[model samples]
Target: MAGKRKTKASKAKQDDLAKPSKWRLQHGAFSGPIRAADPETGTPVQHRRAVDTLGMMLASGSITAQMHEAGEIFRGLFRAACFDSMSTSQLLRIPGSRVDTLSTMQIEARRRVAAALDLLGGHESPCGSCAWFVVGLEFSVREWSMRQGWAGRTVHGPVGQGILVGTLGTLAMHFGLTPRAKAA
Candidate 1:
């Protein structure tokens, strides 16, 4: 995005980052030695950006290792199944037997996605929000609840958060990422 691209000077402090700066940098949500190209000269620029949310959540103990693993798998499967399929011409409408063109791996990925949805109780399930909050960075639960008419109430914020946590927990269990209880 144009807004994300930082030029020579802007709100992001410009420094002679490496003539080079060897020190590791970590500020709030941002982390560095990111290798980016200067928009103007195409020179590699060492930069920092707000880093991984999943990692932050993991570090903060908001989610377990199992939850993180499940989230990673959920994200990886969807990414692997990206739009690599062939499309026929608009004028060429063949009446013959249609053939499935997706690769075995792609098909398997799609199956896994369906499995994930099934475990989450389908797209309409409140746990489906984990696919957004855990894997995707669309919005926070607070923002979601506000739009869903859970606004202004004292009970709603924690309720929404609990839903998200429960969602991640469900996924972890479904994927067998959770540890078993002690054998009696």
Candidate 2:
């Protein structure tokens, strides 16, 4: 009886060992077991250099400056777009037009700047909502310009507002606006 009990206990222990670990059970279906990368092994030279460069840019506040510039460009576009009578040249000539245009520009600029900072800090991904808003705004501006004979006409009054808005929006995303994830 004692020998039988010992054999059963040993068998149970062996069976437990044969099963996959809890971590493996959770993450192994799609990929193999997760293992930490060895730091001593080191990443490839090119990858290491790229990482270093990005780190330096972040540390030196270059990315933040770039992001600010991008936002400023967008804000300029927004100011330029809101004018009901000013020609494109006139709008271009003026710097920091009165803060009386659509409130959307202000909100979007803030969002873009915040998103860029978040991306640089690795706190969040790029913002898709902001990108989409800009895209829609660009389309509307282009259509409005066309209707007003600003673009798609013999005398091109000014650079298309659509182009400016689209460019600014794209720059914002490139600097670090998080994109939305597709549903699985």
Candidate 3:
């Protein structure tokens, strides 16, 4: 052989690098065989079965389309409010202090988020408790569960996720995005 041969593990990794990723895990639930990636690095990984929370829930019939829309809207608002900007404020250029500023829309978005939080009640409220974590931070159910447990909270897997779903429903109602019920 003119050069070093490819080891079985290396060959296997190369083969596994391009697999499609549809499978997901939520609170230890499993699904796909998609291509994986190193969590810390962007390099290709192998044999990853993790999936996104909202997509998996929609596909698995765990959440309704309206709920999904609501969740997405909430996530969108959070993303927008964050991405819209908060550069330094010149209105108060008294010194070298960097005064953060936001546009009217971003302010409105933050207000809306505040209103949404109010609608969800407080940090102690069941639905409200997990809303920010799941919607804003986008934690997976398993991660949320672990975090809650670590925080000295009672963390039932299904119930925790249910609270998140319920919060999305509440958001949908707040946004007027909920679909009216069809008559039987």
Candidate 4:
């Protein structure tokens, strides 16, 4: 009976091993091999130099953002690259952008709404270019808010107003979304 059981177990193991492997091979997941001659140049492509150049390109904002989703994606990836799980807000906070004592949900919802709008219309360009545009506007608004000396209750109100006004100005210039300026 023991021998019979041993035989049955061996048969089961054999059947398991004989069954077709469950793993399917995935494709195109690696960097390709180096060719002898460079097409662009009439010289052989130096693999090490090419790799170093590639790393620099990834470090750059425009190419990186173009390859990735956008500044937001880059920010997340940057946070993750640190090998820590801390939230992004905890990583970097622009001055005057922080609310002293707000709920996490409220803060996150605001950020999400802004991120959604930013991602809309396929605006996934690099921060290197767009930084000047977005941060310039943000800076102007912050200055305006400071000048206005917005009170406790109206702090959000002034910032909202500034953003709305700035966005309208941008749209007016770019898309003629609002009435075009008349020639003098």
* lDDT per model vs. reference: 0.64, 0.40, 0.70, 0.36
lDDT of 3 at 73: 81
Q: Could you tell me the lDDT of residue 155 within candidate 2?
A: 17
Q: lDDT tens string, model 2, 51-81?
A: 2222333355644444445555544544444
Best by lDDT: 3
Query: RMSD per prediction, one decimal?
Result: 11.0, 20.8, 8.8, 18.3
Residue 97 error, candidate 1, Å: 15
Give a tens-digit lDDT track for model 3, residues 1-184. Answer: 5998876665433333354423422234545555768789989865645456887888989888877888888777777678434555476467765456567887777777777888899656666657667877688776776667534676878877887777877777777876445211
> TM-score per candidate, in order?
0.57, 0.18, 0.62, 0.19
Q: How close is candidate 3 to the true structure, as a TM-score?
A: 0.62
Runs of candidate 4 with Cα error greater than 4 angstroms are 1-8, 11-102, 118-184
Tens digit of per-residue lDDT, candidate 4, span 37-73: 7777779653322222213334553233232223333
Q: Which stretches of candidate 1 lie over 4 Å from their true place?
A: 1-28, 34-49, 83-101, 132-139, 146-156, 180-184
Q: Count the backbone clashes (under 3 Å) in each candidate.
A: 0, 5, 3, 0
Which residues of candidate 3, in runs, are more than 4 Å off?
Answer: 1-50, 83-99, 149-152, 179-184
The full ranking of all candidates by TM-score, starting with the best, is 3, 1, 4, 2
